[model samples]
Target: MINTFTKPKRLYQEIGLRLYEELSDSRFSVGDRLPPERDIAERLGVSRAVVREALIMLELMGLVEVRKGSGIYLIKQPTDNSLNNELESTLDNDDVGPFEMMQARQLLESHVAEFAATQATKKDIIKMREALELEKQNIEVLDHNHDADKLFHLAIAEATQNSVLVDLVENLWERRESSPMWKQLHCHITDQTYRKKWLIDHEEILLAIQQKKPDAARMAMWRHLENVKDTLLILSEHKDPSFDGYLFSSNPVQI
Candidate 1:
């Protein structure tokens, strides 16, 4: 039997689409107040966090209004343009392109580094140093050390004291692992040169944060991601049109 089934969606995304459908069906009229997160969560047999994420998606799509301390309200329908925009976002999550993920990481992590420069304590610095050490050791053993790499970045995000930024950083890293483009791009990195260069880049970022130099930290993080983006592009150039040339072949390299 040839079974055909779509991949399962994340819990929150499934709930988000259900909520959107309810709104589209006019079950919740414009300006009508939606139920509280707790009520919705209980009714749907899901956690409040799931409902909250779903509502956030609606809010982002301009379909709902979240009034502080009041409640969520239906603000508008998902217009054609909004639906198109949300469709693109959904597809990105399913199979985000490596370059798209890199661009998002550069924008978010640069600020995370800057904030960590001012906010990181001695403990955070120690953790970052430990992660960096692990990365070096793993590279020496040809282990790739992806978890340690993530820890180094996540440690900086934690130092920022912003939960949203931390989640954003975590989300980007999670997507990187699932991105087909990213996996294909990494297949070209069989040698240690890139890893060695990245270790030095990580050290520069760590030093800037340790010295509490916000601007330097931001620039260092930016350069690190920029180098990564360039490397991906160059490596992609070497592959056949079927592998990478479809999406990035005609795109100009952006800093």
Candidate 2:
């Protein structure tokens, strides 16, 4: 008998949902081998590509393990890490603004700093201090080293003692590499004085966290983001026409 299921409008999502449902059945226990791609495509009346896409989604959700030569197997039940999921979503959107990115960083990193203050081990604190020192040196050279900046942030995230938050912060930094605002800000602000000021602000943030003061850390992050916002606004006003609605909108936090 022919299966009567029609192909889904969004093939990837439809395939993902179908795979998710199939995997959810108790019969598909952990480590159970999944049917081959061809078999799945035939059974679902969809192309092999759709099945593959679905499988990728399943892998991302932590539902299945894909072994190159051994085929796919059920791994474990899926668990959502909200911060990682949000970072992934933000990375996928091309129009994400600086404000939105800052807002996300503000929400996630402020809490991360607070946690890091309480949870940081000696090694974590040492790494953070090292990163801060590197940032300080870079400021003297007036170099806009995105890598160093990201490393500093990642060190703070690591101090939180949360792997999930570390991953989220890393992902956000990756997204920033392609961000229009990031590119523009680097081009517009190239002075050593500005770099020194930014480094000093970061130092204050680190000091607050080192003191294990949650409130101080949160306020420091807020002030730093506010400074970033002001800098971006000044640049946007001078060069860019702001004709693109995406550039001027203030939904920095909601994205």
All candidates: TM-score:
0.58, 0.55
Clash pairs detected, candidate 2: 99-252, 100-252
Model 2, residue 241: displacement in angstroms?
A: 14
Worst lDDT run of 10 residues, candidate 2, spans 238-247
How far residue 113's Cα lies from its native spot in candidate 2, in Å, is 0.8
For residues 145-196, could you state the per-residue lDDT of candidate 1 as single tens digits? 5899899999999999889999999999988887554664465455556878
Worst 10 residues of 1 by lDDT: 240-249
Identify the candidate with maximal TM-score: 1
Candidate 2, after superposition: displacement of residue 227 in Å? 1.5
lDDT of 2 by residue, 1-255 (tens): 122233343455566666665654465878888777666767988754445546655665567765543667888743234523532443343533444566678788877877787887878778877888888777667666746667778988998878999999888878878765355334434333555666777788888888889888877876776666555544332222222222223424541
Clash count per candidate: 0, 2
Candidate 2, superposed: residue stretches over 4 Å from native? 1-93, 239-255
